[model samples]
Target chain A: MTTVGEALSALCTPALVVDVDKVKRNAQMMIERCQKLGVQLRPHMKTHKTLECADIMTGGSRRCIVVSTLAEACFYADHGFDDILYAYSLPFDKVERCAALSERLDLFQVLLDHPQALEQLKKRPLRDGRRWHTEGVELTGIYAHCGNTYNCRGVEQIQAVAQETTSFTLQFMEKLKAAGITCKSSIGSTPSCSHPVKDMAQLSEVHPGNYTFYDVQQSVIGSCSLEDVAVRVLTRVIGHCPHRNQLLIDCGWTGLSLDGAGKLPTGYAMIEGHPNLKLLSMTQEHGRVEPISGPLDYSKYPLGSLLTLIPYHSCATAMMHPVYHVHSGGRLLGKWTPTRGW
Target chain B: MTTVGEALSALCTPALVVDVDKVKRNAQMMIERCQKLGVQLRPHMKTHKTLECADIMTGGSRRCIVVSTLAEACFYADHGFDDILYAYSLPFDKVERCAALSERLDLFQVLLDHPQALEQLKKRPLRDGRRWHTEGVELTGIYAHCGNTYNCRGVEQIQAVAQETTSFTLQFMEKLKAAGITCKSSIGSTPSCSHPVKDMAQLSEVHPGNYTFYDVQQSVIGSCSLEDVAVRVLTRVIGHCPHRNQLLIDCGWTGLSLDGAGKLPTGYAMIEGHPNLKLLSMTQEHGRVEPISGPLDYSKYPLGSLLTLIPYHSCATAMMHPVYHVHSGGRLLGKWTPTRGW
Candidate 1:
């Protein structure tokens, strides 16, 4: 039985919790920044995958959203999201579904980068031994990925990669034009989109998904500050092993995610206020935190005490849970369920 | 469209494929080994939360199985499995659900390691604002975690850790006895259980989960042979970048998992039959494989060509997929859907 005062703490251990204030601030900040830059902010629903959060991101407009999976696309589409971009390169197995969704929505776009994908996209076949006739299929736009920007060390490097990616995408658009099929091309990654670009006149849209939930990896890549991290895993200290100098937590790789800190050497995640504690290793259900200084202070983190961790990569961490417990100022707000499946 | 002959390759890119024959073999080998060792093998269903797999593992007995999550416990219980051990230390929030589940099953055990967890266990609270009478709440046993075995270097270290874990568990069991409550105590990890033990008079059963589908991480830890691996991720080469010296695959951190080969210098995963191809990096939907040797032949790996990857950790990798495509001797048999969510 959970009392009203301890509702958040009473949740199951290793639960994914989002600071509502942080999320709203993060969404509003991105919206304003994108507005200032004169580009529409197509929030990637892949991060939160919640209708409530999506409504906040687009200010209830549901104008444009990006999805990583068809399941997510179907979810937002059912929720009245008119313009949805299936940001992944078109896979042959999902062509028919995409085509059908395109017919239903005001705009539904699928990405095309590789030649084989382009060829498959042109066919638009269904898994049920039927192909959508060329005229029946309605594709919103072709999207390109500036995935290499993730490797960029600085803003200048990211900008150069962005230019290269833009040129490459435009060249692919020309190929589509030569094939007698033409559409607007969309391109952007978090790193590339976050970096200032002089020209996006050649592209129809920009999709930067991870900007909504900046993580330790983003900080290491110089994409966002540590203070900008929105989502965190709420966990409990389960045990303390003095011999091993480790503090076991309920959050494991399944909760915190296995994506390591890109350039930061602090380990898997950063404990909100424990600078001396380093998450050195993890199992499926247990996280082992080692002290960077001397022997650990057990009293500092008593058993069953709650601790929040800024994940190494928010996108990957979000995939491990079904719902996000939204909270603000230690008060429980609501729960947001993520669209699951591939 | 998916035709009969192209079933394996036709479904989707980056899908989890299980070799049924290999699973049967792995099951049979472990069962025989445990029989010879004079121990009851309580197979942990956390690795593959499939009823069919569980049936094979338990030899159609449907007697004993271990689960990582309450959802898995419920899954096997609903499928008529009599004994289910939720192999994690008890959390306060789940006490009520655990109590109700205990009422439904012949045996439903929850692990308790810390003093606080024990106090919560003694309380026997439920989520629906009711208290489970101590007499009404039936706990099968207390399970101990030898999680440190994951960090052990070799068989000797694993055995030593096993002894230490067993002793620790026995001490806790003694404490429970002193408190006027007594139950069987269980302790084992894959490493400890796989290694031979002279005595087990103090422990009731061994729970070895990951031995069912061993991976590169298990192989590196000297737990299982690489040949014993029963599952692999089937992916497609989406693009080949000659300038970048990388082969991009449909498998990403989402499919193949972000769990790296612990203690092994190999990147994310080992390419089946492609030793030279190192998984250098990953994004949400793209895995970057760089050739260890000079790479000039794009023809060697044509676009959309299927490739198999032996994951770093089978348990973590399996969690990413909704269903497992069962195959034997290169023939598609059936699809096994995993129970999703917490």
Candidate 2:
């Protein structure tokens, strides 16, 4: 029922609002970064699974995207997206579905980390002349996730991890070539992809998802600045619990998620423009907010007043919302409904 | 695409399965307990916001229920449920929508904890000559949630908190009566209601959710036993990370949520029938699970094998799932879709 052109304040509280301008800028920057690196940018859709965001991330090509679940793989494939990669370690129970996608899509890829998974895939061969592998199971490629970069404090650490992953991956690819089993190689993480090293240019492709919607964690890790975070949970002050020295907001764990707990100076999320205010805790549908240093000024935050929260993790927060209210400069554009479930 | 009479193992990984028989038993127990106490059992729909579960919780009467969000209120109202109480401190931004529901429903109630919220309600009087108050905004009642009971470890501690809350509520009701403002008084929490003090019978109504789908958190708090818990997240072991001494599962924070972190020895949730295993960490789509004390015997859990996860908090876990695969004695019955968003 929320229409276009309305101010963001008109929407209900605890709404996830996406700054479309920032999304486009972020997506464009990633695209340009990969273009410069001479590697394909296979954007991951696990961060924001909506088709509209997928279009933005892929520059409307709708090709060469990595998905975390089969549901996403099918969703995008059904929407004309081809060259999809089911990036998680292949789930054994979903081989049939994976086979269907393999036969249907022009280039449906799957990842496996064990021999048993490969056997499972072998048992379910695609029909209609589709082949998942070239003779004996094909070595599709080597994919490494530099997830340790998440613990990095800044760009220097991130690039170090990226460099190590690239060297190791390149070394493995050389060994594969020597064994006469040459295949493509790819490595990624938001931190590593956001600040790629010179060595990463040697890779075949890079798949990073979270860069499209930068968040407080990304800012803390020096992947992007606070200004680059594209999404915010727009909540409103609903109650004043003077006795507890807390102000209640409509956003809770359901709205913002329990991601980045104990990692933030603020309890759950960073209150934009209000560094002293900490989102102390949350229940099912109520978030408790309080000042970090001193007593709160109740007169400053009256009932129904809007408070913007920069989420600690955009992927986690975005999953809580069924639809994202797309906006540009505080004016509503429309909505982007994301696909859910595995 | 999932159908009835199918074994749970036939479904894909990371599916939330609810035991229908357990749900009926839990609902019937709550109804009988409240009936014996001579109090109106207005079950809460926040835990499982599905019409089928709501039907089970309300004993098929489709009347007298509580919801945590306005969307839930509207959902139940649209489905012909009546006498609804939105058990939330009145949100100022939702007053107009609340007014519409107030005018449309046969009996819709809203909760307000502040004078400003009351003022906002007064500004928007109900149409069709339906008055929210007889004169000067008549007192509706007092409602208290003994959330502190969540901290209790046993039935004794739970009843102690329940007794204290009931005494305080009765004392406050006496004060309201002394002030010549007679109205209904109600109080509830899953733990408190599960083991109600004798004095709770004197109250006009009680609202408790989560009993229908009791979880590990409630079981730990002595609200119910492990056998009483009705929900389990069905996941499959997708990989064996022997170097890291872990098994990867399809249930991540997105599948089972991060609500009970550090609270359980099993990490995020209790892996049913595997007391020795711990869900150490999770990424977006993968959960790293390992043995609690020693190296895991990976042979015992091959890839494609199913693992049952009893969530720490059913409300939190239920929120993560888009559909609940209802089953009876391990045979799938149907899917129950819950409402989302505020």
Interface RMSD (C-alpha) of each candidate? 2.0, 0.7
Q: Considering summed lDDT, which 10 consecutive residues are worst modelled in model 2 chain A?
A: A129-138
Deviating ranges (above 4 Å) for candidate 2: none
Residue A49 shift from truth in candidate 2, angstroms: 0.2
Clashing residue pairs, backbone N/CA/C < 3 A, model 1:
B96-B126
Q: Per-residue alpha-carbon lDDT of model 2 for B1-342, expressed as tens digits?
A: 567898999889799999999999999999999999889999999999999999999989999999999999999999999999999988988999999999999889888787788888888988998978534658888889999999999999999999999999999999988988899988989999999888999899999998999999999999999999999999999888889999988989999889899999999999999999999888778899999998899889988899999999999999999999999999998999999998
Per-model DockQ: 0.46, 0.90
* Chain B TM-score by candidate, in order shown: 0.87, 0.99
Off by over 4 Å in 1: A1-6, A92-94, A103-106, A114-116, A124-185, A191-203, A219-227, B1-6, B125-185, B191-203, B221-223, B261-266, B340-342
B15-74: candidate 1 lDDT, tens digit per residue: 898888888887888788678777678889888888989999899999888888887887
**Chain A structural similarity (TM-score) per candidate?**
0.86, 0.99
Candidate 1, A1-342: lDDT as tens digits? 333445678777788878777777877877776676676677788777789888888878988888888888998898888878787767766777888887777677677666676577666644444333333334446676677777877778988998888788788788978877777667767888777575655677787777777788787777778888878898888888998998888888878777774434568888888887788888788888888889988998888788888898888899888778777776667788887666
Interface RMSD of 1: 2.0
